[model samples]
Target: MRAHGDFSRTADRTPGMTVLTVDLVHHPAHSVLTLHGELDFASSDRVPPLIDAVVKAGRRRLVVDTVGLTFCDSRGLRALIHAERALAALGGGMELVNVHGRLLRLLDITGLTGVLAITTGPGAGQAVRK
Candidate 1:
């Protein structure tokens, strides 16, 4: 796997705030994006452009590893949905991995668990459609 640049963004230097970092790893089968820190409104907007670039580069399947993700707000969820849609538009798909805790609960509460592909480990999860 070849690594791409790290995309880290900070909305502020306020105390108790975590910076969002996105690490991209490219493989023959797919591209893996590992997300760290918060995925709130402050950092959500940074994801789509990267996804678009990946698609433009001819990579279709995407795997988002959320093990390092600490928190995600509604806007963050919207960004993820957008990613799925973006990939789906190209006959590709996005999978969320290492999901647990509040984020997992949020997906369940919002009924997104059924809409988005998710797994606790690599190669897990089914492709469920709306």
Candidate 2:
């Protein structure tokens, strides 16, 4: 299978916060985005456009790994929700993986734990063979 990722070095400054750095893997079945840094008002706006571009290209399922993600505000959550809805409308879905600590709680409090197609890991949602 063919897959691609967007990796970057160095930080881009925008006013007070550094922009969220996203590493994306575009695959035939799905797109995997490994997000680093913070997703707040300053950088949360960076996500949807990218997700839209992916969706527009016909990739449906989206798996977002929040392992490297540090901080996320309301704006970030909004961006995620928008992407989820965008994908849902296309008959696709979104998943969250490697979530822990406050981020997990945040998703629960915001009710995204139910909204997002969450998994324990990349393969957790898949049925295991004995």
TM-score of each: 0.85, 0.77
Please give the lDDT score for candidate 2. 0.73
Model 2 residue 18 CA deviation in Å: 5.9
- Pick out the ten consecutive residues of candidate 1 with the lowest summed lDDT: 121-130
Measured over all alpha carbons after superposition, the RMSD of each candidate to the real structure, in angstroms, is 4.5, 4.6
For model 2, how does the per-residue alpha-carbon lDDT over 1-130 read when each residue is reduced to its tens digit? Answer: 2233333222654456444678666776787777877877767777877787677667888888887778788988998899888889888888877776778889889888877877665565241110
lDDT value for model 1: 0.81
Candidates in order have lDDT scores of 0.81, 0.73
Backbone clash count, each prediction separately: 0, 0
Question: In candidate 1, which residue pairs get closer than 3 Å at backbone N, Cα or C atoms, i.e. clash?
Answer: none
Task: Give model 1's TM-score versus the native structure.
Answer: 0.85
Best by TM-score: 1
